[model samples]
Target chain A: MDTAQFNEALAHIRRFETMLVEDGALILKFWLHLSKKEQYKRLKKLEKNPHTRRSVSKRDWRHAKLYDQFVKTAEQAIRQTDSGEAPWLLVEATDWRYRDLTVARTVLESLAKHLSLESAQSEITTQSKPLTPTGTLPSTLTILDTVDLSQCLRAQEYSQALETYQGQLHRLAWAAYEQKCSTIIVFEGWDAGGKGGAIRRMTQAMDARLYRVISTAAPTDEERVHHYLWRFWRHIPRAGRVTIYDRSWYGRVLVERVEGFAKEKEWQRAYLEINDFEEQFAKHGNVVIKFWIHVSQDEQLRRFQEREKIPYKKHKITDEDWRNREKWDVADLLVKKMAQLPEQTKN
Target chain B: MDTAQFNEALAHIRRFETMLVEDGALILKFWLHLSKKEQYKRLKKLEKNPHTRRSVSKRDWRHAKLYDQFVKTAEQAIRQTDSGEAPWLLVEATDWRYRDLTVARTVLESLAKHLSLESAQSEITTQSKPLTPTGTLPSTLTILDTVDLSQCLRAQEYSQALETYQGQLHRLAWAAYEQKCSTIIVFEGWDAGGKGGAIRRMTQAMDARLYRVISTAAPTDEERVHHYLWRFWRHIPRAGRVTIYDRSWYGRVLVERVEGFAKEKEWQRAYLEINDFEEQFAKHGNVVIKFWIHVSQDEQLRRFQEREKIPYKKHKITDEDWRNREKWDVADLLVKKMAQLPEQTKN
Candidate 1:
């Protein structure tokens, strides 16, 4: 943990971030600091036991050798790179009483930031953008409307329909894989707007051999080091396979942008950057599907409250939701911007 | 390479695979190897240039001290963990030319193996077992029967329909991202069976913000490690995002199983394993969509012949296609197996 190496790592991080943005990705970082005393205690325990000792790397011991330098370097990195588009949340990990609470709150806040951006961007696309004649459909119309939901398949209509679609998609996906086709799907909506239900319904019908579901939340340590998009890029489906996102990269515009965690330029440019990315995807022959579930804000409140009341769903709610509820107007403005973009404008 | 350590890695991989089976995830692993001679060449190159000098590690300079030990360990790891469910592909890299060709063939063959298994399993579910109702629609219906091709949302009629769906899905995918939902979609069909057409249609309508397409062809040096399924798993969609596979995981039954690249048991159990995996996906609320474009064998032949006559499509007529054509009965048997499985069994 020589201060020089620490500073150099920070520089490396900055350069890495620039490259990520150039490549159409963003990053959010965090630093969890356990006090020197606490680290020493943990080190002592490990030293006392050979079993635990094996897991401790020589690198760890070296890091411990210069704890102060490590801390100072981490602090410098945080200070230098933390910004609206990519912010760093520092956690004091000494007191157990405070650590969990602080970490959870910060994570909740970050998630809120990301989710709000999603909400805002969705609102913009669905609400502000006027329908175009080239290929764009009216915003009010639902893809479901095209389906003959009323034409009823059977007693097990949902299951049967799900199976039919999943089976065909599975096979088609494999064929695409043979041809090197990559797939990405997006889902968004008001709270508890059946996004999860819809995902389960669709996934339940396919062969798991060809697909996988990834849930995104707060960034982990390794994730923090890379750009936000880096983590997501890491999840890109190989050619001919499916990669689904419950929530995705739009967080810059919807959550981070609206919540002031990201500057206007950051989220504003994301619309174009995202379009460029999709252009690449299309060029590669990826089958890209994006869905937004619509529900009244009142429905969201009901679900939010319900989540608070349910033990299992309790994990779903956070104080930040309450805070976000208060900033609907700000969020709405961002949504309008998202909606104003052309359907397929290349960044 | 050290045979013991090689076996240890192999053992670790097998353990990981078993764990994934019970956990409903596929464990894919990779081993990257280059011979000592090649390594020396690289080191020599690096040492010869001022800029490339740092590429040589102290470890390389002291190879005499470690090479024998390392090789022995690596070999041992490889042998110990090779299993029926997950086996290792030994890439002989003494000759770069041979290695490249071998690796490419191995990848294509490996993919075929897994896909054929999926196909066979589906066939068993659809044919061997009772196609009894577990509540979903029958697994044999064509996409044309279900989707309203006649009631077209014409270019001018609610022209924004595609964009709307894509946008909505985009938001939904991001929401899933926040929630960390995993999603997968697969497409399978004969060549010219509208797999590419359908995928293009889907992509044309999607918001680029939330989706990506991955095209699978021959594997490069990087992907050969890990199990065949590892690369696919790496792309699992984060919650709310979707991945579409033009051709997907069914290669086991359709290609590998038919071609004799995989052992009987490997492809046989993929059905149950696949089902278990899908069930886990459903439990986790990720969506999976599978598509199989059905075309008569005559249709396939006509298309294959057409590829030979056309300059652009000529590349599509591979010797393997002709080889697979010779084993139509075996291929059909595997396809039947794939058709037999119920969505409930897998999803």
Candidate 2:
């Protein structure tokens, strides 16, 4: 058989499930089990019978010889893929009648359960109040509204403070490295919120070798294929190093949530997931610093106009920035909700 | 001082080496040490003088209490950053004059050595034969060229064999998960060599949740800012999962080497780096499988044309594929060299 045709056939089998179930997909799997003695007995019978002789090939005997390897491999696969939505049923195949009966019964049970679920869902849709998108948090006051965005620094004062902090950060970076401690600095802000300037100031003070500034952009095709958090996990700094995110996983709740890019349930669950992710960093004794750079709407507008006038900075101002600005109120509310979550879950 | 100005001051103090030295960078560091009693006496003197009083802030007094922490952090930094090219010199600062003299003498000595080495390099260039690229391996026959591309599978046989192998692979994947063993499969082949087909066949048989197929492309901005291999290191599968690389870190030698994307020296040293990386995976008990799918030039051309005729597959055949084909011989030779490196370095 040509490899291409074989691969095509394999593709056909795979189309049953192109991706893992993000929600639930009904899938039934059965594993037939036979003792070595029983397998050997069956093999001999197949070889003797003309109708089944073709099925008992030299490869079959070779596989039987490596039965232990097969068993171990099967056990691992079953364990990894076993979940509430999709499960494997191990059947004793020594007796064909028993194996068939057990498989048939299991399939019927699953079908009945699935039918009941479908009917129940329909009944609920007709009988209950329309369901809101899953994962919406209650509206409440948040730290965001309390921030004093009107606060401004004089040029001389800004310069002096920048130098002081940069110096401290440099020394602290070296200290952290010496102690084999890693650091993750997250910057979340509005458009033209001076994230770029602040990150530049920080990087300028540290040894380029000890820190990396990860400018988060749209997810790549490979990243888009995996869990949302997988991309962030891939970039965690090693011991004693620093990774500064220009924007970060908060996008799942911020941009992704406000823009409706992520389902309500996905963003809702993200609070717990993000908290868990941060806890792992804390457990590893990494310094985790998060900064929310805030700016007033008028100041943001001024910066946008200034960026447009400066040829070099024009690219930084985009249609998306304007679009995001329009939904600032929604983003503000969501961010406030997110901020409260960490404090609640901190213990 | 405002925070900005403080940060600017901090940046000024951080003019020391900011990043790790990828190549040798001339650097000199001095660790000035003073006895605790001497430090206390100096602090008292500074406090008495109004001019020096401004330099000694409340933070300085706070830091004095954690002198041990400072010492430990400094020691660690020195240890980690110490290399033959950029060594740290410890100087006793009990007397300011002695510390200054020691540092000055060390700097002079290092400068003299560097000058002499620079002259020696010029002389060598004039007197000796041209230097070969560093880390060039000896030419040797490898498994790559020995593959018989003409060996083909019939359609019926291919279908049957694929089913058998996919079944085995499916089972093995599960077993690996149960045993908490991760797997890494690397695919490197000629354009249109059916790598995608083979990978699909393997993935089809296993659960999507158990494995990830990473299609390597040009590095992202974040990836570009770090070491070339850092991106690959970020994606290593956790225990009980499988990661398949469509193209991998081997690109340093293959594409980067052939296309001049990497310097001659950088690609040359990658063989050892790659060996070390694989050894780490092996030590972690990962099942590593590498495939070099062989196909004749005629077959490759045929497939390329076939892809062009199919609307969905047309995008797969790009101008780059045609260009890459022009350098097939170079890639083949480089690959052969790379294949032999693992065997030599296994010990």
Candidate 3:
């Protein structure tokens, strides 16, 4: 109800409208305005008629009394939300015929304009070009290079540290439960970067009652019908619980972007949508943590081979995985773009 | 909420769970139990640790005091909502290891069962068989037969009646807008039955600001990804607004049923789903009206030929319309089923 909340809502609605328009929706909003005097005249005339009198409720009278204030507030909202993509039309409503005709004409014109450009609109060139790892990019010194591969933990030390950390995590999960703070953990990684092992360790530390691990694979037939984020939203954690996503919404910008599964506009707009979504978590006092695990190409190859050699793990290595291995430039773009997202938008 | 509202919510949730399971989803619900003494002890211990003390809030102590009440409420909820499709598993949670292991084991078993039956599930026989006009159903005395085609309006009288009715409807629309009552009009009809013509007349009568005419056609790529109902739900009328649908969700049971676009189970399940959806409209105090226009086969053929002869109306008659003419039994089943639906369900 406050100005800040109202303004933010207006911004959110405008963002949605712009996104729809960019995606080729023909949006035309109209506000049929009645003059305060004309509105009063119509109300009184309806009140005089027994059959129509019941229609004019107390709320209508109250609205009529505050018509000027209502108009002012509406004007403010309209001004803030107005956009070239989905422009608002203000029509005078003294004559019902004129108002109806005007609105219908506008609708017809918008539809016709949309239909005429249908073929041409399909030829819009995507702005995103594939990242070429050679020449335009450095041969070395990537964000992945910052991970010191030589770092290792001895078995005895690893066991001790793991127990201590796990114990702490178990206690923290309970404490968070007590405070009604739900948590979301998003995992993104190279195909063979040991995400499953890391997730298993994390889940092992927490009481199963307190967390749900959702392994994001391909979209199911049901999920395919909704927006990509719909499936993720459907499984949001309840209060005092945790949801861990193995491969999260960042797929739009990472794999989908590189693999051409998502068009440039879709993946690009997803950056803002994701930020807005995370903002909801913040607003609700929930905890969100994300991770990106990187493995060198040689290390990935080693793990892929190790998986193939194992009887139970053979299914983990697919032809798609082998195909994805050729896209090193994807990792470069993903790392850089992901690192910059928080800086570029309000989260 | 009142007891009635609470009970209705529980029933709604159980219904949703049943639908999901029927659609081949494997669902699991769990309740992790802890004694009041154990909960108090844990809270006390956490509060004593500086690292974890910050996580224990006043709400935790309040909840501890209401532990018995919470347990009773939980029991009632569990009793009402539990079903074989998604049964709740209660785990004794004094031991974290046992609780976590129990949950993980249950999940594994459910997944294993689901995966094992993947191939066998696809062989499910659809219950619905196409109706033949020849023998099975009565060849005459259909619901459509009740309509007297001999009834006709004089041109002069028709024009006067149209103006009078249109004017009354226009006034009523504004009245509904003033009273904040939304109206949803659903039209289901055979091709060349004047659904478009009727919708156009209705919209012409109402203020364009107060009504939107949604001409339901084949699902767009975006819509095809969602449930068949998704497109219908997307254009729901706002408060005081009227949404006139030229074709409607009844297509699931009508065209999709006879045409086999939706399997028997899908269409059969839609009967209940559609009722529940309309129940929401009633709950919101919105107005809903439905219409089915039928034209005799000979009359339909005459109109088809007449339409084809006119250049402007040529697009109105398509090959699909000519093809659908072969399925008179669709109209028969549609009339009987649609007529029986309200009586069969708690609509």
Q: How are the candidates ranked when ordered by TM-score, highest leading?
A: 3, 2, 1
Tens digit of lDDT per residue, candidate 1, span A210-277? Answer: 67777766566556565556667888887667888887777666766554555444555667667766
Q: State the lDDT of candidate 1 residue by residue for B1-347, as single tens digits.
A: 36564554455456557756543343334565776777777778878975446446687789735767778866766667666566677776767798778777777777777778777866664322211123123335433335442353568655577667766664555456557776677888665566877777677655564566666654443455445565566776656667777666577556765555545566666666566555556656677778877666677788888989999888868887776566654555556557766658343
The per-prediction tally of clashing pairs is 198, 42, 2
Q: What is the TM-score of chain B alone in each candidate?
A: 0.51, 0.64, 0.79
How close is every model to the real structure, measured as TM-score? 0.32, 0.43, 0.66
* TM-score between candidate 1 chain A and the true chain A: 0.53
- Tens digit of per-residue lDDT, candidate 2, span A234-281: 889989999999999999988887766776566666776677678667
Give the higher-lDDT candidate: 1 or 2: 2
Q: How big is the positional error of residue A119 in model 2, measured in Å on the Cα after superposition?
A: 35
Write the number of the candidate with greater lDDT, choosing between 1 and 3.
3
Restricting to chain A, the TM-score for each candidate equals 0.53, 0.64, 0.76
Error of 1 at A344 (Å): 0.8
Per-candidate interface DockQ score: 0.01, 0.02, 0.11
- Which residue runs does candidate 1 get wrong by more than 4 Å? A1-160, A345-347, B1-347
